[model samples]
Target: MSAPVQVGPSSSSGGPAPLEDLEDLLADIGDRVRAERQFRGWTQAELAQRAQLGTVALSSLERGRPTLLSTLVLACTALGVDLAHVMSSDWREPERGPSMTPQQAVVLREAAAGGSLTEIGARLDMTAAEVGSTLTRVYQRLEVTHVPRAERRAAAVRMAVQHGLITPQKRTS
Candidate 1:
């Protein structure tokens, strides 16, 4: 199997983005996919069925692992989000903000992966309330608490992904 990609910032000159840059870009795209999916209250399987993609494929793409561009286009279309907006390379706003703590990142990542608060809390050795509180703090830190209460989780995941706190995890499924 090929080595997993490493996610980082893009190069300024922009000849060909380094492998790390590509990794970051994929993760960014994945974040957008996850955020959109969450915003619509769709699970990976639901989106996958809509897009005619496999659940594993959708999961991999949402986790920021490398995926075919066509698959991404399919998912974007299925989610009803503009492809260009989701694929934008400009990450300036989040990059300028403070970074999230490791715990915060883990919490956001698990949420983006569609983990229930209780499930995530169990995995992290915390109670569901603690998980919810951590997510609330993340929303405050990312300044996204102003978002509608129902959408706050999605917003936090999107912002955390943009801030580079949530890189692609190794393929686990």
Candidate 2:
């Protein structure tokens, strides 16, 4: 019922996939999403609500129509499924048009290192509100602003790490 979403370059070779391959991938994701929702006994409306999405959006996704990365993430989150379950780990986020600035990198690095907004701002001589706004801008640059605000930090940080903007820190006991 949904139109196939076009995919960008593949992560492995940084080249575009054949259109049919992309279509197959989208169909697979739709099938998996539908299965997950049914497993939980949720109707389209119920899953949409849990994902903070509209039913039409959910329907489009389930029908293997054009899907947004943010929509897929939100639905996967609500379904308590890992992205790996729905997509290949090798599948990277499509390239966003703008590059990250050095200041934005610093902000994301601090956040990834577990600094709170207040702490990051204090060290950077900015107000917490200013830090939040900066992060918002960074999210925009990363094209992840469509994700819920609560989930943006994690999403952006993951992207930053993938882009070599920051290295993930090791956890200490």
lDDT of 1 by residue, 71-133 (tens): 665565444344465668752332267467888888888877777899989888989999999
lDDT of each: 0.72, 0.74
Q: Pick the candidate with the highest lDDT.
A: 2
Could you tell me the TM-score of candidate 1?
A: 0.44
In each prediction, how many residue pairs overlap at the backbone (N, C-alpha, C within less than 3 A)? Answer: 0, 2
TM-score of each: 0.44, 0.41
lDDT (0-100) at residue 26 of candidate 2? 65
